[model samples]
Target chain A: MNHAWNVTRMHLRYNSIWLYMPLIVLFSSFFINLIIAVLSDVPIYTGGVASVYLFMLITGLLTLRNTFSFAIGFSFRRKDYFFGTFLMVAFVSFSTTVLLALLSYVENNLTNAWGNELYFFHLPYLNDGNVVIQACVIFSLMFHLYYLGFSISSVHRRFGRYGMMILLIVSLVAGSLISAIITYFHWWQIIFTKVIAYSAFQLSWGIGLLTIFFILVSYFMLRRATS
Target chain B: MGQILEINGLTKAYKDVTSIYQMSFTLKENKIYGLLGRNGAGKTTLMHMITAQLFPTCGDVKVFGEEPYENTRVLQQICFIKESQAYPEYFQISDVFATAKSIYPNWNDGLANQLTQDFQLPLNRRIKELSRGMLSSVGIVVGLASRAPLTIFDEPYLGLDAVARGIFYDRLIEDYAEYPRTVILSTHLIDEVSQLLEHVLIIERGELLFYEDAESLRSRIYSVSGSSEVVETYMKGKEVIHVEKIGSLVTVTLLGKKEENNKKQAESLGLEYVPISLQKFVVDLTTKSREKVVKGQ
Candidate 1:
């Protein structure tokens, strides 16, 4: 257990860019929006918080190739690396969610959206529920994205780049086929209405289940991954 | 005196190509072993399997009497340094040492620091910026300072100069004598490391060719040169691994136990008998095995 934590610490030291880049993008986006609002005399609505999730997702992919291989070279078992990476990802997601929630609270209650109606953290349809529910939605979605990236990287590691390319093409064809079928049946409107019918909590729980599925897939793929 | 590693029928195959085929060996504690082989002879594959970095297609690798796959109990006792080991791009040399300190329970800070100074490794420079020789030096320092019970170096000094390589060997021998442990060094520089090896494991075309004590193996094979007729008559019914001819002179390398009677007979027969070095012996052995493989193909 101590060794696993040490591996995690080592990963955190090497990949700290993933944790800080999100905040950098967030603040940069906020300041740019603030300046635009002040100069143009107009309201700025942004969903820059999504950048944090995007960065984390990319980090998930990069770390598997970089840090995971290095850790294995250092004599860490695949299980220890998986556990350590999971701990790091979970901690980053939880902490980022809390930070985003606090910023949302301050934006909505204190600064009045930066006094120019600049909506960054408190976006509509996503933050329409209690703070805890909003945090859950963001956290689950972030985890889902991260695991999706992690699973793809694991596939690339276990199987080669050709396997990942084949997977991409297959997924694209499957998605296109599904979209074509839906379009032929004229069911896009019904799908959208059904999607909007679910509450934020229910949607988050559904995505949470998908995240678990991705996590399991990533674990199996990673188990067979070699340096 | 106890066995540190026991491998049984270990095989690794990729698609239709087998890198290692049903190899088995046992490594005793507190001894330096030389895993000598030509390129693509499965030395790295065997080391990878023992370290649990690469999985075997079939068979078992036991370290400290337990399966080493994903077992931290076994992994913590072993340190494998390869020529192609990757490092995180964001790390400095100091960060690597720090992480090694945390991972290896018996890490020696004093030794690490001393080696850092000896190797002249820049602690604050990113690993990406280091030259290839510097990178190898880092591996040597880590392998030496970690003090793991089982340390394996698979061609860990690829880009090191002769002076640096000598320093590494000297430091390795000095440290090892003070703190005895099992060490396996896999390299193609058989002559350079021949004196350092207590045991020799020679692999040819992914198969075990010989495993014996270094000193005994050195004495087992020898070459004799003389008149063609005299050498041919003397070489009758003996295992001749290699032969060379110059004009009317013939040189044949024989593989057998050294006996006083045989030496006396060769001397009395007007044949010049010369002992073959480990390097020459391995070259002869691998070349013969490769020719046999080609003939079979």
Candidate 2:
């Protein structure tokens, strides 16, 4: 196959960098908390809002689906297209993950020396290092698959505006339905439906399953797009 | 002369609306051929089919004796410059050059860079951010520098100012002279490229109207100008393709041999026989053919 890496490289240089905004905002929020601890003589390990930072991680990845789809040759082989996008996302994620870890490490040490009991969550402790890593990996892939597939299906057609509107409506409806289903269904007897709704494990599973389903659905829709 | 491109009964229809119908034409190597038609006359459609960007609904298109669709050997030897070439929002002018250099094996980077400077295209500016004229310049530069055996320019000079367009035409002719190849220029700017065209292909409403040498086309239709009454009387029992009336002056485009009798009759009636510009002749021919179709329908 005639690979156009130069073209792909330019695409990532400009668009892929935007995908890291969530990590940037997350690190900035942490840095702010660290600064406050420094001024108040409090420890850096003290907990802050986990939900805001996690939400940033999820939405940032989701929003990037459009840019990734646009940049990569999604019209070509689906495997290669998805692989290219996954590689870029993985690279960005790894870089940001390392950066955040270092920042947290320095803050934790500073606060510990000051004798303030500050609590910092390392990525490895997000819930069994392997589990969180698996969750993040699966979550990123699934989220990307679903968003890319849905957008490619609906964008650029005679009823493109209507298609996009319908896609948005369907995605929102699907997301709510999943949330509602999880709200009703208990998992493993130990975790209640509401508890699963609040837990990161369920979030990772939901995203992974949804992404796999989306990939299958998108391949079908792509026949129409490419036809 | 060896046949560089052969399009056999090429038919392209979208949803039963035929854009090109059973069109067959062969382009000889080292000749500049003009693909002429009014807008929606299927000129661009034929070009697209030839370039393998659009597959023909029926018939075949061959470049260098092979199918062009996904046949890299054929495609590599062909450069298709669309009127508005779409690029990603992030792709800079230099990115286009970089991609073209790889895509077209015959791509001359030195020439491409030179054209960039001549066209005054900012190498770092994204393609989407460029002005319409600049975008066209970038396309022209690629089309020319690619130096493909089968080069096609489908109205590639749109939105370019007259001076810049002149530069393009001059550079194209100069380069083409130094290195001859099969060049198919599809444009509404017929008069501008008339001198450069060795042959002409006229399409009228999805059908190939005429395909002949440009010299023969000029000889095929001769304009007879005189008083309306006298010219109309002389034009009887003759094939008059187009008739233009300006006040009392009647210019009848006669499509037959310029016999001595017809000339004498025109001379006796104080008429003048003027050579029709290739552009005007082609416009009249296609327009007249279209009028006949409309009248028949």
**Residue pairs in steric clash, candidate 1?**
none
**Model 1 Cα lDDT, one tens digit per residue, B31-55:** 9999998999999989988988899
The regions of model 1 sitting more than 4 angstroms off are B260-262
* DockQ for all models: 0.81, 0.15
Per-residue lDDT, model 1, residue B236, is 91
TM-score each candidate: 0.96, 0.75
What is the lDDT for A38 in model 1? 75
lDDT by residue (A128-204, candidate 2, tens digit) is 33433534643454355435544454353213456778877998999988777767784435566555455454466
The number of the candidate with the highest DockQ is 1
Worst 10 residues of 2 chain B by lDDT: B256-265
Q: Which docking class does model 1 fall in?
A: high
Clashes of 2: 4
